[model samples]
Target: MSTSTAPDAKTVRQVRPALRAGRFSTVLRVPALVTIAVMVALLLVLFALDIAIGDFRIPIGRVLDVLGGGGTRAQRFVILDSRLPRALTAVVVGAALGLAGAITQSILHNPLASPDLLGITAGASVGAVAVIVGAGGGAATGTLALVGVPLAALAAGLATALAIYLMAWGKNTAGGSGVMAFRLVLVGIGVNAALMAVVSWLITRASLPDASMAQHWLTGSLNKADWSTLIPAAVGLGVTLLVAAASARTLAALRFGADTTRMLGVKIQTQQGILLATAVMASALATAAVGPLAFVGLAAPQIARRLLRTPGEPVIASALVGAIAVLGADLVSRTMFPIDLPVGVVTAAVGGPFLIYLLVRTNRKATL
Candidate 1:
C-alpha cells in the first residue's frame, strides 16, 4: 500500500482552530452542566419543602405518600387539593418569568432588560386590575371572570410589548447597537410609569372591597392558585419553552451584535422580532397566572449567567433559578412573617438591593 500524504498548512490551520474551539466549548459545558444539575436538585428540595411545610405540617414521608396516592383523605385534600396546586403554580410561573427574562435580556443585550422594567408586566397588571375593578371588587364569579382576567392580561401585555417595540424603533438608530438598546429601555420606563398611574387610578375609583381584591392580586399572591389556573399556565410555559429551545442558536448569534448576526445568515430583524414575541407570550402567561412578579424575571437570568459563567444567558438554568427564587420567596413569605405576605414583597425587597449592586458594579466597570 502507498503511504498517505501529509496534511497541507492550510488544512492544519483550519483544523487547529476547530479543535481549540471544541475544547473551549467543552470547558464551558462542563461547568454549566454541573451548575444545572445542582439547581435541579435544589428545585426538587424546595418543591417538596413547600408542600410539606404549612399550617398543618405534613412530614416529608407523608408528602411523598400523598403524592403517590396512598395517603388518607385529609392528607390527600391537604397535599393534592390545596398545597400541590400552589407549589406547582409557583414552579410554572417562576419558570415562565425566568425564561422570558433570559430571552429578553439576551435579545436586548442588556442586563436590566426584564419584562417588569420594560412595561410588559405593568401592562398585564393594567388588564387584570381593570378586569378586577370591572368585576366590582372581584365579585364577578363563574367562568367568565375566571377566564377573562388572564385573557385580558395576555392581550394587554402583548399590546404593550408591540407598542414598546414600535416606539423604540428608529430609522436612524436602526444601524446602531447602543442607541437602540438605550432608547428601548428609556421608552419602557416611560410606558411603565404611565401604566402604573393608570392602575392606581383604576384602584382608587374602585369600591373598597374591589380595591382590596385588586391590590392583593397586584401584590402577586398565590392564594388563587388552583388546578384550573395551574394547568393552563403549565401548558403555555411548556410550549413557549420549546420555542425558546429552537431559538437558542439565534439568541447566541444575536449576542454577537446585529452585524455579526446578519453575517452569519440570520435575518436579524425577523429573528429578533420572533424572539421578542416569544418573550412577550411567556411573560404574559406568567403574569396571567400570578399577577405581576416584580424581580423574578429581572434577576433570574443574570444570576444564572453569573453562576454558569456563560457569556450569554442560560435559558434552562435561568428557569431553574427563577423557579427556585419564587418558590423560596413564597416559602419565606408564608413562614417568616406573622401573617402570610404576598410573594412579590419578598422578591422586591431582595431584588431591590440586588439591582443596586448590579448598577454599582456596572458603573465601576464603566469607570475603569
Candidate 2:
C-alpha cells in the first residue's frame, strides 16, 4: 500500500468545493434551530403587543394578568370577549394563509402562486356573498346563517379550486407530473376575474343594507370575530397544519425537480394533489372565518423563506411570519390610523407594491 502525504495544490483545489459545501452546510445546521426559536419568541411578543396596544391601551403586565384571569370585570370583558378572540383569529388566519402560500409556491415553483391569486379567496367570497344576498343580508341573522356562511365559503372555494385544476389539467393529468405552473396561474387569473364579476353582480342585486354587510365581509375584517369564528378557524388550521407537516418532506423533495422526485420514488401527482388540497383547505378556512384577507397568503411564505434562507420550504416560519404580518397590520389599522381600516386593506396596500416589484424583477430577468 502506498503511504499518503499532504495533498498537493492541484488536489487541494479539486477538494475545495466539497470543503466549501460542508462549511456552508454547517451554517444552516445550528442556526436553523436558533432561527426557529427566535421566531416563536418573537411571535409571542407580537401577540402580546397586539393585545396591549388597543384603544384602552392595557399595559403588558395587565394584559398578562387579564390573560391569567386576575383582571377586573371590564378588563375581563375587553380582554376575553373582545381582544382575545380577535387576536386569536388573526394568529390562526395568518398561520393558515402563510402555510397555504408556502405550499402553493413550492409545488408550482412560482413566487406568485397563492390562494388569493388563484381565485380561491374569490370563490369563498362568492359563497359568502351568495348566502348573504340570498338571505336578505342584515335580515339573515340567525344561528343557521352564521353556520351557513363558513360552510358556503368552504364549498364554493373547493369547487372553484376543482374547476381551476380541471381547466389547467392539460395532458399532465395522466401521469404523476403536476400541472404546468404558468398555465395554472394563467387559468387562475381568468377564473378570479370571472368570480369577481359574479361577486359584484351579487352585491348589486342585494338591498343597500345587505350590500353594505356583504361588502364588509368581502373586505375582510376581524371586527366580527367571536367564538363562532374562532372554532372553524381553529379546526381548519389544526387539520391543515397536521397534513402539511406530515407531508412536508415529500413536498420539499418536489422542489428539487420532478425527475429527481420521481427517481427518489415519490408519486409526484398524488403528492401534489395532497399538498394543493391542504393549501386550499387552509385558505378557505381562513377566508371563511375572517373573510378573505389579501396578500397574507402571497407575502408570508416569501418573507419566511427570505428570513430562513433555507432550500426547503420554511413551513413553520411561514406560519409564524403570517401570524405576525396580519397581527401587525391589524394593530396598525386599529391604532395608527384615524379610522379602523379593514385588515385586508392594509395587507393589500403592502402586498400590492411587493407584487409589482416581483413582476418587474421577473420581467427584467426574462428580458435579460
Using lDDT, give the best candidate's number.
1
Instruction: Report the alpha-carbon TM-score of model 1 versus the true structure.
Output: 0.91
Clashes of each: 1, 0
Q: Against the unseen true structure, what C-alpha lDDT does each candidate score?
A: 0.86, 0.85
User: Candidate 1: RMSD over Cα atoms?
Assistant: 4.8
lDDT of 1 by residue, 16-93 (tens): 122255434322356667889999999999999999999999999989988988999999999999999999999999
- Rate residue 92 of model 1 by lDDT: 94
The residue pairs in collision within model 2 are: none
> Per-prediction RMSD in angstroms?
4.8, 4.7
Q: Please tell me which predicted candidate would have the highest TM-score against the true structure.
A: 1
* CA error at residue 266 for candidate 2, angstroms: 1.2
